[model samples]
Target: MVNINEIARLAGVSRTTVSRALNQSGYVSEKARKKITKVIEETGYVPSEQAKSLRLQRTKVIGVVLPKISTETLGRIVEGIDEILSASGYQILLANSSLNKEKEIAQLKLLESRRVDGIILAATNREETLMQTIRELRVPLIAVGQDLPEVSSVIYDDFNAAKTIMKKMISKGYRRIGFIGVEETDQAVGQFRKQAYLDVMNEENIEIQEGWMQQADFNIQSGEASMEAMLQVCSTRPEAVFAVTDRLAVGAMQTIRKRGLRVPEEIGIAGIGASEISRYVTPPLTTIDYQYEEAGRESARLLLEQLESGKKSVKKSVMNYGLLERDSLI
Candidate 1:
């Protein structure tokens, strides 16, 4: 509860001098600044965050809006963001939008109202309304994982990554390959991965079987249900299934085991998003390592750069992805 007044009284300096020192203003003498700082620290004099923000017109806080807060990929991304922001003396404010456009827009406005210095958004899909709002906002905005054409973004080459995995599977002599993904509205899970699969299959002259392709909500339960549906519908079940995420692959694996099928011997399963659990699963998952943490760190760096430079140049940064082969596929 110690305020600047007590520090001022102890330092025998005027309130103006105390304010200048605390704000790191050039008006304060170096010797006086040190003395005031020592007194403030010794007394534990905490300045009013609201007052400081008002005076400086900067909060030194970054808002991170994640599409799905509970996902493992998002968790690691946030950890990376926190590491970078903490080192830079900036705090993080988190908002979970659950892939809802309305909620995301509301959270953006809330962050703006709180005077956040910048925002890093892990968007669900490209929404024109949300993009327009972000463009009109005063704070620096950086998109992560998904991109807005007019904004700065740090994203993985999702389409190419998926294509690489499909081609690898095909080369390994896996002809009956299935694709389990989220709703097509989700650009990352649907458009990117699904389109890549189709393109690869068509180029390889593989027939497109309706039953081998399924879309769900990108959760374990949805994955399980999708796999079961595929098994029921497909006359010739897929020899390998490529899930859009690790969670989905794990779920599909479980379903396969329950059906008395041995992995790789009977069915092979792989997925995107090389989460931690992917490496620890029973047979270990063969998937693409998207470098979620690197993406997060880069997103933070881009936002910080914009905040410091006061420039709005459109930047598109695509990080590399590695295909991690484990016991599950080979």
Candidate 2:
């Protein structure tokens, strides 16, 4: 309950001096700082965060908006973000959109309303309204996982990564290849990755069959259903499959095994996202390691730099991806 004034009086220094010592903003003599510290310790005076925010015009908090919260990719990215921010005396305020486009936009406005210092959006889509909302934000904003226009972003090379995996499959003589993809609303995983698959197949002059390309939700069960659908409809089963995500790949693998098909021998399979479980899955999934944690760390660094410099200049960082050629893909 002791105030700054009482601490100042006890320390035999002005309130301004006490404030400078406490906030480490203005210059305070070492002698005066020592006196203030002693008085504060004895009085057990705790500074008010609200008052500090009002004075400094900063909350020392970053807003992080995630499209979905239950994925391993997101968990790793958040870990990286927190690792960086916590070291610099800042914390994150997380907002989950539950993979809803409308909720995504709403969360942005909600975080802004809370007066967060900045926002890091793990964007799933490049909707016009979403981009417009980002453009209109008063606080600095950065996008991760999607390359968006008119904003600073950290994105994966989804197209190239997909192409790499697909080419690998083709080189191994997988002419009859199937694809499992999510909806194109998620531009990074859906549009870019699918485009790469199509381009590779076209370049190789490989004929894509009916039901070879199946769209599914971002879940294991959806992957299972899509693979089953392909088997039921396609006159000739694909020799191999490329799933846009590792979870989907795992599901497809399960379906293939359940149908008495052998992986890498009868039905080779590969996927993106080098999740932890990818290693333990049967035959070990061949996947693209997108460096998700690095993306999160980089996003935090960019936002912090903007906050420190008081500049909202647009900056873009394209994260690197690597192929983990595993047993799943022969």
TM-score of each: 0.84, 0.86
Deviation of model 1 at 99, angstroms: 2.6
Roughly what TM-score does model 2 have, to 2 decimal places?
0.86
lDDT string for model 1 (282-315, tens) is: 8999999988898889988888888778787789
Error of 1 at 145 (Å): 0.6
Candidate 2 ranges beyond 4 A from true positions: 1-53
- TM-score for predicted model 1 compared with the true structure: 0.84
lDDT winner among the candidates? 2
How do the residues 1-330 of candidate 2 rate in per-residue lDDT, one tens digit apiece? 799899889989999988876665566786886677667656667555534453445768899999888889999999999999999889899999998999999999999877689999999999899989988999999899888888899999999999999999988888999999999988899999999999999999888999999999988999999999999999999999999999999999999999999997899999999999899998999999999999999999999999889989788899998999999977
Candidate 2 clash pair list: none
